[model samples]
Target chain A: MTTYSLPLSKRKRAVKTRPPRDALFIAAACALGLIVLVAVAAAVIPFAGDPARIVGPRLSPPSAAYPFGTDALGRSVLARLLEGTRTTLVLSTLAVVCTAVISVILGLVAGYAGGWAREVIMRLSDVLYSFPSIVLAILIAAVVGPGQAAVLSSIVLVTVPLMTRMVSAAAMSVAKRDFVTTAKISGVSAPVILFRHLLPNVSGTIAVQGTYALSVGILVEGGLSFLGYGVQPPRSSLGLLIQEGGSYMLQAPWLLFAPAAVLVVAILSINLIGDTMRDRLDPRETRSLV
Target chain B: MMSASHPDTDTAPVLELREVSVAFTSGAGAKRRTVRAMNAVTLEVAPGETLGLVGESGSGKTTTASVALGLKRPDSGEVLLLGEPFTRSRRANAGKLQAVLQHPHWSLNPRRKVGESVREPLTVARRDLSRSEQRQRVTEMLEQVGLNPAFAERYPHELSGGQRQRVSVARALVTEPRFIVFDEAVSALDVAVQMQILALIRELQAEHRFGALFISHDLGAVERVADRVAVLFRGDLVETASTEEFFRNPQHPYSQTLLEAL
Candidate 1:
């Protein structure tokens, strides 16, 4: 065969360009990375300051030795905050990971295997979605009897519905794309087409949705703990800290502020990271944003 | 090597569609309606011959292509590929048939690189080829279509429309299929790029001697690439003739009108 090119070489060279990266997006990603690293460190390393130790006077203000001040139990607020980050991050990550795994399977099945299977899966999802996630988590936690396992499972249950719905919708649209049909006509096997073509196309959407789910999972777990239905005494969850600190809000204030700040930071970082990913992954969103 | 070549002798046609019909039904009971998409469209692409199926937008050109590709099973008709009864399950002769669809941007998966897309058929159908052999074949096909081997690493979006079309051609021909359906493959391209793609397709078809069903609306494009041209108007094939005969002397009134319109 002859190698005859259309006089497109010059044009191709002319159009050699890169998509501009947003500074704000870069900053948010860096901040999120730093937050994740700190959380991982807190989870892995033993804290030098004893979170449960009564080392100082109660209701103390922030100081060099006890940064973030002391709680009602005269325990170091800094230590408790680190331990709480570990607890929150671990539970939220587990819940999000479980929700993602289950949702991906259900969503792909619902979207690709359209008809009675799709109808059943979607109806099940609808039943779960009808209830507010927090209320659903609380109800599940209440039923299972308060413990860490119960809290984790409840958050997973609460999140799976929304994640599945998003993934299914994304999969359906991706399934309709010409490449899917192209792959089909090439005599590619069904499983190969599904896992290779359909799954990869929808994965960006899944990642973005999963990040959003992580933020929600954290909030739900915190709410459950605050209500005395999650993470029983001595586990040192951020929500439990807030619960214990609520009564002495007027006096110390630092007790509530310490854990509250960490929780807010975690949620905010995840949301920001998720938004950045969505913008980058979906060209339509990026176009609209520009 | 297959008995499909040499149409001058009495051999089986590379592709044959006999009285194929497709109708879409809508609504129920009192509001029922049937839209006839294709009406007994009988056509054939001889071995090593290019048959251009030309028609307006709703003239059932795409429907004809779909039937040939086994994408949509016709309501009633006998379709044959390589002298075998064309079943919807095409796995028995997978890589022996292929297609180069329109919209190169959409035809190629966005998540995959060009090399993966080009070598997909071989990967799925030609399990005999080693990984290195497949890579070599991909690069060779890319070169044949006037693209660099480096293009293997680039995603579809990174390439120009013409370059992407080249990748599409490489993919279609990679399997060395005896029959290929090019559904308006160059229509989406600019005039210059269209000519280059047309030239490249004709060149490759000449080298491989594969029977081609080139579906397009462009009269000049069809005349340039097709050995025979079939005109469709409103779900029915109006006329078919050798390229010279059709151009010099159009018989049917619809064909005359279509030529005049062109």
Candidate 2:
């Protein structure tokens, strides 16, 4: 093969320097850490009103009296918010990661192997995707029972189809590159080629999709929790707190306002991270922007 | 008893293609159509001779090298190496046949150091050479190809176009493959790099005494290094002779036009 060497200056760094650790990663990681801290505090804050702590009239209004206002049981609104953050973080993270892991693995295997295998796996994904997202989650939740397991499973079922198809396409594209062909001709085993060439090349898709699945999982789990079919009471969630605050919309709108704002911030930040990651990972984005 | 510089070497062609034809499928889906990438073609190369396969793109120059190296299957042609056809040789015999491609940019894995890429042929052959032996071989191959041996630690991207191609050539030669395929291997290189690579190929051939099928679209290059030249047009064997004869007495209309173009 005819080979070209970059001059000492050019060759030393033809590898695009990895974009410095992404800002979105740092932001998302911080958000995740905050959620975990709140969850841990909810469970072991050693206070009677940490979500377990109950006081004031059931529907006390927001004031120095209750920063988030009292619920129906006069429990501290801030306590419920903290506890809700814990539940939301735990369930959404699990569901999102689970979907991403399962789908990306299946997609890489199917697309990289291709032929009959691709047809079978991709067909199954199509069938799974045909069901409406919430309805599918609801159906699984109904069977799995209206709790965290039910909610997470439902979301996973709904989200994996989208992720699998996207991952498969990305893996297929990477697998077919000239570099991958060279790897094959070098007598590298199929498995090594899959991991070394295919997966690393398409990790951009994985990161982009992971963030998306996470946001959707959070929103969906929150919606289910609000409907009283997720996380369970006493566990508390931003969704449940929002649902509770929603009923007394007039006396203490802050009850709804607090949870709704948190949800928006959480989803918007995650989405922003996903978008930024996609832009940074894909040189095409920079090209188009220029 | 593998023959080493045997007297019979002058008798049996080191590599031969008996009626090789390459058919390529074009279009997509239901519109798929098959075109003769190469028609019934036949040629042979004696050991230590550089037999050049010259053709335009899609004329099956690359395809010829591919089949000769067992990279592609011809629809109904025989690829004979060392007097025995490729089908007759054991697949493990692959170490005897190697190919160098044109796009040096994509030939080596970008992740690997040059030494690793060059040692790949031996690695593939399940060779038990010591690490030092392999390293020594790689260094010698690099220097032999007119590249700085210090490039051993470098990645493919670190080298210029000519340097990468030399690295690839070193990789192919590491195992001492008796038959080598050059699939338009020099066409993509800069003019100066092309001459250096061509000269390197000639020098390596003389040292290793291996037969080579040098595929290229450039006729000037063929005249420089090729002992014999075979002209292919639309996959048909248009002309085949010693480089001097082909240039002096152009028989085929396409060959005449191509010679005039260069």
Candidate 3:
């Protein structure tokens, strides 16, 4: 018989070799915090300059006066990048909030009801989930027409299916638990059981999925804007900046480099935080290693 | 060793399962197979009586409990709660029929306070009572189960296994239910804890005068609390007799085997 065992000294050494999980979580939080600070500063402070105004010579390299150089329009790249951060964050947050509300409701109903209602709702979501996310977003954006509203609608359409599926799965598992049945036996109303007993248990799943949806929403917004179907010109978005920067890639790579770097960091931070929350919120994951 | 006070035979049975049968079909097409979980099993619990159902695992003990609790619908036969057809209106039987499951953690919501759990049945069944009244009843129920009333504020995870079992009993009794199913209720506890809980169940049953279906595989536990013992084997009810008669002269070979194992 194989009895799994590990020496205490070896376990201790293994833990010592790597930074604690909490350290990585804190680092990611701080990185996202810095991005938010910059976005807010650009929105509130006049000193950050107008992102759309021509403030320097076109395609200028990084200089003391123009920290991230200038874009093809002779606009300050740093200012445009900060402004793009604010737009991306705000749009993605709004889209995710909408997705959370719609998906959580649908998921709970499908999971708890478990009959023809489940079949209808799950089948509808299945049809939505069949298409690739970006392709679906593009289709929705095309129908909606190019603008912030189009991008917002596209993000919600693309993200809602996955979020709804996740919440439904979580709710189904919780509904099968004995407490839900206990509540039923106690004569608690159906709505009360759904909201009180079922919802709180699945809230961890909602929080975790919300973070992933936020990241996906940001990426969808960037993709839509890059294709000229989102946030139109003069309104700086990280995608639009990168699209403009692509043309002057050889002459000045800073425009693409600056916005792309910030987007990557923001998504990475959110993903790390989501992972940490999953580990912390789930009681099963917190059990001591044998 | 039977108690002198017998169950009131004149009144209608508090709960009854008449020829109840349940079968589960799994898979589909050529692969389909049906498993008979319970085969026309009949039993009854009069007011203030405990009917012990002893069977090995997979012998339909749980299916019987499920049918009695109205959690599962029988393919054939009928269930009566307080002498009325159980399926007529579930709302009518809600708080009157409650259960304490094997695992306290399973029945008690981990996120809810003990008090809220005990008060839930009252909140549903006795809506006319004020919130303060419900709270007072909850406190009284907690104390009756041998726990401090203050323990009500704590979560299930904060209590020990035995204490959690006490909380489960408190939750079951809060509505002053006419019938409560103890499905392997004491089987999950330590031997010492089992005795304590069995005693608590007997004490509460005497005071409240409710009917009980005490299901377990442990013959010792059955002997301790059940007034009459029913034996099931392979979905078939083999024999039933009063506690003393069943222990002294088991009629069926399966019942004899079960006693020998004990």
Q: What is the C-alpha lDDT of each candidate?
A: 0.82, 0.76, 0.85
Q: Which tens-of-lDDT digit does each residue in A172-201 have in candidate 3? A: 867766667777777787788888887877
Top lDDT hit: 3
How close is chain B to the truth by TM-score, in each candidate? 0.94, 0.91, 0.94
Clashing pairs in 1: none
lDDT of 1 by residue, B45-130 (tens): 98778999988888888888888988789999888998888765757667888888887667788878889999899987788999
> Residue B116 lDDT in model 2?
78
Quality class of the docking in candidate 1, CAPRI style: acceptable
Q: TM-scores of all models?
A: 0.87, 0.82, 0.92
- Tens digits of per-residue lDDT, candidate 2, A1-290, equal 22233333443343255455466678866875676666576577644265666777878777786777787777888888877876787788888889888987898898788999999999998998999777777788788889989888977887898889888987775565445544445455667667766676567777888888888888888888887788887768888888988998887787888888888878877887787777665322322111
Q: Model 3: which residue pairs collide?
A: none
Query: Candidate 1 — which residues are off by over 4 angstroms?
Result: A1-27, A44-48, A112-117, A283-290, B1-10, B26-33
Q: Among all windows of ten consecutive residues in candidate 1 chain B, which has the lowest summed lDDT?
A: B1-10
TM-score preference between candidates 1 and 2, better one:
1
Off by over 4 Å in 3: A1-19, A283-290, B1-10, B87-89
Model 1 lDDT tens row, A214-279: 888889878888898888767788888888788789998988887788788778877877877876
- Candidate 3: TM-score of chain A is 0.90
